[model samples]
Target chain A: MIRKIFVIFAIAGLIMMLLPLVVNFEYKDSLNELSSQYVRGSIDDLKSQNVVTSVIVSYRGLDTLGEVTVLFLATAGVGFLLKHKKNKNSLRKASELLQTSSSFLVALIILFGIYIFVHGHLTPGGGFQGGVIIASAFLLMILSDINLKFNHLILHLVESFSGAFYVVVGLIGLLLGIGFLNINIVPLGNFGQLFSAGAIPIVYSLIGLKVGAELTAILNTMGGEQ
Target chain B: MTLTIIIILGVIMIAAAFGAIYFNKLLAAIVSAGVISLLASVIYLVLGSPDVAMTEATIGSGLTTIIFLFALNKVRKENKK
Candidate 1:
């Protein structure tokens, strides 16, 4: 039946998707050996607040840049999914209690999110995690049944600007002959502290802001009525 | 041994997922798929990719369930007498 055909096609698709993993096995051993040495140097030099961020922004920065672009594309695509039709009264009125709690929660979340984003250079999480937390706060607002519509103008401004800044940071990397996103041009700050990793944390914060805005816009676009 | 264990667990997850699909209840099938995704994601974690594992669990299970629920509502409405 149609279901059987669908299953067959899905299996075929999965096989194709997994082909790369199998192919990559050939280099896995050699890659791991090389990384074992690099990992030691990274720890010594970067004294990174988070090992993952250091790896992302230092060792494998080029890949991180590509990953950000993927996220950017996803955000853009999802943005279209939640396109606004311009109805001021699209959502229902928010109860006073809901409004109070939502405002309280949103403020708290934004504050905590900022803390997380700033401390990313010194802590476990980076921009992406904090950004998602911020977006979730906005999603909470959307769920509060508030008729308050987010200003598309403000979101568009923030999104476009942050994305531009991300690329500019990469351009700085290019200038250093480090391809895209090499953070070595800027002084690597003290290991295990805020304001460290120079441009990496700053770029991460920009990514956070852009991601938070984009995700919130997407969720808002997919409103309750839709 | 590790590979064998992973393969065994993955097979079980896939089998359980198939069982869910074979059943008539859409919710059951969706829940089973979620379980399978979680299991496969854990394998990814064992292979040293917590990020990919997190994404697999989040998008594979979380977003998928939302989408299925949305479609389920539409289907039920279409079938209304």
Candidate 2:
């Protein structure tokens, strides 16, 4: 009873502490100086239509690299922890409806994932979202067929090469004295076009591939494969 | 109209969060958590951040739920043995 009372008091105290901030909060009418600069830089300098993408893949590319590294560590940790032998005998067949629909839907889902990352410069969706979408397609496949074998070699190669190439692209910018991960190495074609944004699309695509492979490897490991 | 929608979503998300904490079955709790993420993604879209909404929907709702289900399944199998 005392514990419950204490919990209630704690909750009340927390609410009281936060209430003033909530009450005093006012929405800003326009972007602040930093954000307005980012918006302008994204449009004029980066030639990217999506301000968020430029901020993520161009201005703050190193932070995104760190994020990808964190994801890689996670994938490695999951892989290390869940090293189980494949038990092919205990698998049950999926429903006929699932079997048929997943086969047809998987291709379209993967295509959509590709589209998302490819258009990351122009669209709201980017490498992480696209990669997760692709991984979901693999998850669907694993759900429909437990005995299905994913070639681990191919997954690892994709993961490693894409990560290496991401760094190499950044190095190219460094070699050109344009700063690391600068997207101005290649021509920033035309604004609002797929080919625009110079190395942003390329770097984002690499991120997409690496993330997709790492996630698929994680799912494959969790699906009872070593 | 937008305020009403946001209010409704907020209420539902709170209810789902409570359900997640209170549910006895692990699967039900996992589903409840997914529901919270899905609702949050909708709220993000309503708040004019489609990028955040996509990430929340795909990773938070979709893959996290699947990973949890996989963990649950593995645990259940271990218990049976």
Candidate 3:
């Protein structure tokens, strides 16, 4: 009986803790004019029609770079944590039917993913979206149990080149009159072209590559029977 | 009517969130958490925070769910021999 009372009191205390904020009736109009500046801007310059994309890929590009680096670091950290585990092949051999059919689908999906990345500025998808798609293709390779050995050195080379290039792109923006990640210095190109939006698309593609590579490496290292 | 529906949905969502947080089993926790994430996205849209809603849907729900599943696989492996 005492335990039941204690449970009831605890529930009441929890509700009391949540009461004030939930019951408040403050107007949100002031929040728009006052807080919009810090939260939303930069829709025009990058030729990115999506304001959120513009802010993330252009205005705050550096932060995204840092974020991707953190993902890379996480991949590395997870790899380290699993390093000492035993290693063997995780995927069993695919049946002949799946082996033949999946390759064509993989190619098509990869092409589609590229299409998504290239059109990011004009539409909704971008680096991260395409990157994950590309990673799935690599994952499919593993699932097929195809012993496709990747050149880790070349993989590292590409990763470093892309990472350095992203930084260089940011530094060049600082060098040129605009601040870091000043995406408008180069020509915006025609808004909807594959080659549009100056460095935005390039950076996005590079990000796609980096994310794809890191995720594949992490999956290979961690998911393999290790 | 729409507002009432939204409020009901929101209450259900918050309940799911707390349920997810309070669960002891790991896989149940992950699935409950996913339900909360999806519901949170809906709530974000209803509240007119579309940017935040999109972010919450994409990264918070999508990427985060995948990451959790991956981590859970690792945890499951650890719990085994």
- Superposing all C-alpha atoms, what RMSD in Å does each candidate have to the true structure? 5.4, 1.6, 4.6
Sorted by lDDT (best first), the order is 2, 3, 1
lDDT of 1 by residue, A1-226 (tens): 9999999999999999999988887543455766765666567776565666767767776676677678768767865764544433433477788777987899899887777677776765667767777876877777676565688899889888998888888898798797677677678878766767667678778878987887676566554343
lDDT of 3 by residue, A1-226 (tens): 9999999999999999889878985766565662355344433445555555666787677789889999899888987887786535344577888677777778987887687677666666777777777766766665565466667797678777878888888888899978887776678876556676678887887887787778777767654543
User: How do all models score by TM-score?
Assistant: 0.69, 0.95, 0.73
| Comparison by lDDT, 1 against 2, better one | 2
| TM value for model 3 | 0.73
User: In model 2, which runs have C-alpha deviations exceeding 4 angstroms?
Assistant: A1-10, A86-89
Candidate of highest DockQ: 2
Mark the regions of model 1 whose C-alpha exceeds 4 Å error after superposition. Answer: A1-31, A81-100, A176-179, A224-226, B1-81
Task: Give the per-residue lDDT digits (tens) of candidate 2, residues A87-200.
Answer: 535657889999899999999999999999999999899999999999999989998886788888899999999999999999999999989999999999999999999999
Better of 2 and 3 by DockQ: 2
Q: Which whole-number lDDT from 0 to 100 does residue A212 have in model 2? A: 97
Question: What's model 2's overall lDDT?
Answer: 0.92
Q: For residue A3, what is the lDDT in candidate 2?
A: 100
| Candidate 3 ranges beyond 4 A from true positions | A1-19, A25-44, A87-101, A144-151, A190-195, B1-25, B39-63, B75-80
To one decimal, what is the Cα RMSD in angstroms of model 1 from the true structure?
5.4
Better of 1 and 2 by DockQ: 2
